[model samples]
Target: MIKPIVKDQQLLAKKAVPATKTDRPIAADLIDTLNAHQTECVGMAANMIGSNKKIIIARLGPLNVVMFNPQITAKSNPYQTEEGCLSLIGKRPTKRYQKITVKFFNQAWQPQTLFLTDFAAEIVQHELDHCNGIII
Candidate 1:
């Protein structure tokens, strides 16, 4: 289902909780929502759909990567750029890392690690910020 994007600042400011096995559906929902808005967005987080779970779907080129309980284990080389959010008003200048290593669960609930760089890393960081209750 493509859930409505939450626009409430107070709600978006609340930190998302880690996902459990039961929250697997949220991952699918995130992917569906991202696909529905593929042209307008590169990523969607569980919190954006009003479910405060640590889940995010990011479009890295032609692929939609769905992750649960995602956390940035390492990052390097900071860079500043403008970014927009589906749940926020306008684009804002944000700082992001050029490279990042994340630990997360796949859609099947298996542990996964990804080494990302450039735009892919930036997109993941943006979604991760949503999980941490930050909008930029």
Candidate 2:
């Protein structure tokens, strides 16, 4: 199910809750939605599709990785940059780390830790912000 992109600021501003096993279906929907917007978007949060769950999907090179309840355990080399969202108009300036270590659960409900740098890290950070209700 390719869900519509949520543009309501109020709706996007609400913090997403932790995703349980039952929320598994939402990940598939999010992947469909992300694929639908691939031209202009590289990642998406569950909230972007109107479901306030702490889930995110990011395109890492040729692969699309889904993360459930992702948390940044470590980050380094802070840098300032501007970013645009599929759920918002125009781009906004924000801060991001050049490298980040995130802990999350995969689609199979197994724990996973990923080390990301540069654009991959940036993409994950942006989606994480959405889960936290921070629009940037």
Candidate 3:
């Protein structure tokens, strides 16, 4: 059974993560979680959901950047911005990075890089924060 995503239940590891193949069931649960919170987007991995392996899931179109055990290789200085998290429904604005770049192996184990800005940028930050047991 899928457990409630208290977010704190499974901590985000500080080390680089590996990718695990996200089966349809887990992906569907992520979708359900996203929808349950009325979240517009989500970036998740099997590990982030409680499994300790590299697998990622996102809800953005054309950005089907499902990665296995992804990590942020680069990020800009924090400038803070209004942010909300699925774990925390009502939220306050805070400063975050203006830009961030990540590197991770795809489902194929090939190295990949992704650059993000604006909403996606924040989304990545929020999701990655979960990887490190952080919530913003």
Candidate 4:
């Protein structure tokens, strides 16, 4: 299990990397870290897990999806709402979209496409931002 560094712990910022033959040990560590993370119906990002790569793991309902270098391939425009993060000391309000689509890789390193809606879509976008040195 990986212990998450609080928002205050974020010191150096990094950019996203193209997912390539990532070493087994590193991937294992990431997975272990993810498995231990706790969120109350929220998503996570690669930077939050130890890498600044554009990747994320979203948890909503019974879904646990992994996104690699996930970019909003498509969006339905921004909508207003509240947003929060584990790194944040508390929950707050923010604006997000109603629908979104992204592209990424799966556990087997295979390409995949994802379509999201409502809060789930917002969660995905939030986590993806962390992968980009964003903290909003």
Global lDDT of each candidate: 0.90, 0.96, 0.59, 0.68
- Root mean square deviation (Cα) for candidate 1: 0.8
- Candidate 2 lDDT over 11-53, as tens digits, reads 9999999999999999899889999889999999999998999
Q: Looking at model 3, report the run of 10 residues with the lowest lDDT sum.
A: 15-24
Which one is best on lDDT?
Answer: 2
Candidate 4: deviation at residue 44, Å? 1.0
Model 3: per-residue lDDT, tens digit, 1-136? 4436545543544432544544434555555555554444466645445654545556555445555556777778677676655445777676678678877765565788888766677776666666555555
lDDT of 4: 0.68
Which residue pairs collide in model 4, if any?
A: 81-94, 82-94
Instruction: lDDT winner between 2 and 3, please give it.
Output: 2
In candidate 2 the C-alpha lDDT for residue 92 amounts to 96
Q: Give the TM-score of candidate 3.
A: 0.66
Candidate 1 vs candidate 4, lDDT winner: 1
Better of 1 and 3 by TM-score: 1
- Give per-residue CA lDDT, model 1, range 52-74, as digits (tens): 99899999888898999999999
Per-residue CA lDDT of model 4 for 19-59, tens digit only, reads 65472234454555656664443567666656656667777
For candidate 4, which ten residues in a row score worst on lDDT? Answer: 23-32
What TM-score does each of the candidates earn? Answer: 0.97, 0.99, 0.66, 0.80
TM-score of 4: 0.80
